[model samples]
Target: MPSLTNQDWKDLEDSIKAAALTLGYDEAVWDGNGVLEVEGKDWEELTEEQQKAAEILGMDEDDWDEDDEGLRYEDVDWNKLLPEVKDAAINFGYTEETWEGDGEIEVEDKDWDELTDSEKAAALVLGYTEDTWED
Candidate 1:
């Protein structure tokens, strides 16, 4: 093939890719709107124009064979999953205390008006009552 400048190579590669897509060539694909790959085809077999075009495409030299596979794009559904993912994140974040501290008071299995005076005194005996607790 003849020599090609950078811009020439770029335009040629674009033309080849457009032709490949229009011809529905299997295993022929365009990547990044500029690079084209043709399986089982040789740079020489392309018309002299093609070889020069590919060169002008500024696409660096690359090779492929019949064994080469094609690229594919797939779609996904995020609408159904996003809400559940957000909710789970919120549920995982739910907590009462945000600080790390020792000697903090925590009441469990105790209700107001249920403790007898003696139980209350026993609680105070164990330092369960705060010094400034209000009625």
Candidate 2:
């Protein structure tokens, strides 16, 4: 992967914080190891009214794991992703195939301006900025 400058890291961190806040997190803290720890209520922690609101929005306990904890963001192994997702990631410059093995993958350089709309949408699903390609 290409080395990110301090400013790049800061911008990425800011974006992550904004996203976490938008997801109803009370706090978002980077652990300095490429992990973001966020404080937020789990499904079980919600009040009755909150639960009803979630239900109204089509959310249910089945949407989450029984042992679910607060949200935490971390790097994903590209090789572990579904084939379609891996293809999208590769198309968007988030991952690349390795020389060895039957196409193992790793993170690659990202060029936000070069991505197509569909690739950008895929990147967004992978927690990248949706407006990176926007003017």
TM-score of each: 0.23, 0.31
RMSD of each: 27.0, 14.7
The CA lDDT at 100 in model 2 is 18
Which numbered prediction scores highest in TM-score against the true structure? 2
**lDDT per residue, candidate 1, 5-114, as tens digits?**
21232355556555444423323122111123342366555665554544544433463212222111101122222343323322323112311122223332345345
- Assess candidate 1 and give its lDDT: 0.33
Residue 106 in candidate 1 has what lDDT? 32
After superposition of all CA atoms, the RMSD between model 2 and the true structure is 14.7
Steric clash pairs (candidate 2): none
Q: Residue 119 CA error for candidate 2 (Å)?
A: 2.8
Q: After superposition, how far is residue 84 of candidate 2 from its true place, in Å?
A: 2.6
Error of 1 at 8 (Å): 18
Off by over 4 Å in 1: 1-40, 63-68, 72-135
